[model samples]
Target: MVRPPHLFAALARGWLAVAVCVVSADLAFCQGADTDSSSGTVVKAENREVSARFTPMRGQWKPASFGGDGPVSIKKTESGDELIEMLAGDPITGILWEGDFPKENYEIRLEARRVEGFDFFAAVTFPVADEHCSFVLGGWGGGMVGISSIDGNDASSNETTQYKEFETNRWYKIRVRVDEMAVTCWLDDVEYAVVPRGEHELSIRIEMDPCLPLGIANFMTHSELRKIEMRKLNVESGSTDPAAVKVESKTEQAN
Candidate 1:
């Protein structure tokens, strides 16, 4: 006896259903692959790499005291680079700036969103005689910008310029520019701080004995990083637009 065509059709349908379920599970796994930084205006991380433009600085490692471990989550995309979370002792990773840079003015821009936790930190540095000059933006229940200098001897000189409040687990756009005699930072197009460079000349150089890596650190107990970007500015052309600056000073204290 031969089976009816309708019975064969029903069997085929059952097999098709199973195939569909398998494909769906595979796609979900791919989407969940370790990646963050989606928006182009932010830090481009798609596949497994991060996109950053600098004077093309290098990396130098420094011992950190935070009692935790974090991973540098990166992804590759069709157009640019992307990053998910950079954690050293916290959730996000630490950016280490250790390189030899020519004394010239430059601009830096990037986007960052807080996913979890209450605080995050990122900075740029110029090392001098075991001491380095830097600008740091930190957020803990809020956000702040400051200037600091660390000597190779482990001594630090620091000051806070802007302390503004920000929502936890949210994305904030940021821009920092360093010119010949001044430095400025912005949070979501808002002007936060402007400091005169004074007599300190920015220097970034690495020697065969020890290489320095230009760095940015995301310091948070538990947080997610959406994007990160870096660009060298043209000081002579004055690429900054004062008219577009926005200042929000609603400081949120750490809980």
Candidate 2:
């Protein structure tokens, strides 16, 4: 049986529409949430360009006041680098991401440097499943570094604690990985803290309650931040797996 010319034309148009829809679905995931049974991770995609920018605008990212916090501003350095400047507070100061982010199997990266004062300058509080914990760098008088409130102990006393001398006005790359098994941190690619999740209860102290879900704070220290990024970790690098990127439609069964 030979199909009519009009029928062939209609089928071709339908196929074109289906192809466009498939491509759109893959890109649309960058703004939505999905889960893969293979990894059992709830991955939330994001537009990295917009998500990583720190312009200090309300609603996207806001300055946090943890008790008499100093002023927060954005400054462009001589090298054309834009950085978020957080002045030291009396007790604590920081900023919070006023947006939705991934809860598990995620990584947060940023560049930070201590400008003055003598305490934590790059402390980050992040989510772990339903609870939260903070990675303290240059805390407890500018040397202690670790994850806080592990099994009810603060970073100053947790099993993940370490001490290192940090010079003023020196930038360091910070990478934190939160996965199903552990919460790990590295400063300038040096592994500093690693805490397995199965045994210890991850939590934050009472003073850090305002920075819940996602936030950064400094304890009597001023600092600058650049190139802050938060992204999900389930997606493999250079992966072309159709199962994850392509969305199939019911075209063959159509009548």
Candidate 3:
């Protein structure tokens, strides 16, 4: 059998191209398997190991109490997404979850939108060990975002203070991760803030104490909350020291 020289060269080039593509795809898949695209955290689970579990605190939230002079209801959007709507009114208006929730080494995620009013649309207060902290979004006149009452300083004056433009009626994804080393937050899947656990005490303001452990409150802002979830992170055993826990505000501390 006789074959043309050019045809043999062309077939060799085609085989080389296919080899290159296979190697490139394998490298990309290996990289993606070890990292989370949304949060930029490394995945610890192997092929046979089970991934970290996510516990649903509220896919559809029911309020323990609805404060303020407005209204709260579970409504479906035009796009068929279910959400809890809080109408604007008093100083605080929203739902509160009084049930038991994880206090450490966990992450909380939710979708929130400011439908009306001029204040914050999401003020999520959760426990950090024995203490508590609040992640405020679209707060302080709808531009400020930060954690409240770090070392007796409010979110506006704290080190995690940031300003972001939040549009009305537009949904934004918010996530917060609390661990022994630091408290990190992401807004719309972008890294927003990181507050390290150092000498500074982590505690909620006195006003936020009523919604302690786990709660969501809005200040004079009509908002909608949906897809609320909490996931426990796999922490190294014996990593937390109970004696190192600091309680800053005795008046607001949960009993």
Candidate 4:
């Protein structure tokens, strides 16, 4: 039952080809790690060498036009958008901004800090409605990050996963991944929610708004923030995990 020498050589060559293909695919993923379509990955903006910045203001959209309800600044990049340096201890409701992302998934990254009086609030809003949108992921104080859809006509329904703690004055990183039929939020690399995509009309743009109230018990009454950033990654075809280059872990200490 011994195989012929030529047949064995052919089989060896085929095995070698398969090995080469596997190696090439791995390298491709490493190179295209920022993509999110095929995989669920969190890519770092700084790793991409994006050097963008903008200033902040109150009651109006920042020069970048990311909106909300508070005193804040905006920075937008080819990859995505950001808001930062939110004034703390103000009794205002905070702010909100919008970006229209059509029928595609996206990656959002931002930083937040809670100071003394009021708790800090950070959110990734999606499923944008006419006058409002749902809170796909958000955090208040040291509580778990909450997920719920909000609109002018519907009551909020919480998505199951939750991100806990998140202290004051310490900068924390937040990321959300939205794909065809699922949405997930992560705080410092820890996953909070991974739920089936909700039923809402797709809007082409996403708006970011931070609410700052000048009164007590408001979104930014006791919060301070900075270094707000965002980046975009084109997900690779037929991939199940996010494409990401291994940058230093932004969430390593949060756990």
Please report the candidate that would top TM-score against the real structure.
Answer: 3
Tell me the TM-score of model 2.
Answer: 0.67
- With a 3 Å backbone cut-off (N, CA, C), the pairs that clash in candidate 2 are none
State every prediction's TM-score relative to the real structure: 0.49, 0.67, 0.70, 0.47
Q: Best candidate, lDDT-wise? A: 2
Q: Residues 1-255, candidate 2, lDDT per residue (tens digit)? A: 101111001124434321111122123222123433332322322212222223222235678868799888866668665578899888888888888788876778788999999999988899988989898889988999888888899988866777889999999888777766567677886556666556678889888987888988888888988777765655333332211221112342252
Measured by TM-score, how close is model 4 to the native structure? 0.47
Residue lDDT tens for model 1, 1-255: 101111001123434321111022122211221212221111112112322244312133343322444655545445444444555453445544334443444455555655555554455454333334455555443465555531221112233345656665566676665554355555676555454444343332221012133455555534443344444433323322211112111232122
The residue-by-residue lDDT of candidate 3 on 1-255, one tens digit each, is 100111001123434322111022122211222322332333322121334555656443555354454677877668665678888857777677755667787788899999988889998887877888898998888999888878888888876788989999999998887777667677886656666566568888777766767888888888988877777765443333211122212233333
lDDT pick, better of 1 and 2: 2
lDDT of 4 at 149: 39
Report, for every candidate in turn, its global Cα lDDT versus the true structure.
0.40, 0.68, 0.66, 0.38
- The residue pairs found clashing in candidate 3 are none
Question: Model 1 misses residue 28 by how many Å?
Answer: 57
Per-residue lDDT tens digits for candidate 4, residues 1-255, read 101111001124434321111122123312332433223333543335332222222233332223334455445545444334445423333444333233344455555656654343544444321322333222344454444432222212243434456555676666655554345556665554444335542221122333211111124444533444344434334443332222323344254
Runs of candidate 3 exceeding 4 Å displacement: 1-50, 64-69, 75-82, 237-255
- How many backbone clashes does every candidate have? 52, 0, 0, 63
Looking at model 3, report the run of 10 residues with the lowest lDDT sum: 1-10
Q: Give me the displacement of residue 89 in model 4, in angstroms.
A: 7.9
Off by over 4 Å in 4: 1-70, 73-83, 88-92, 98-103, 118-120, 127-142, 150-163, 198-220, 236-255
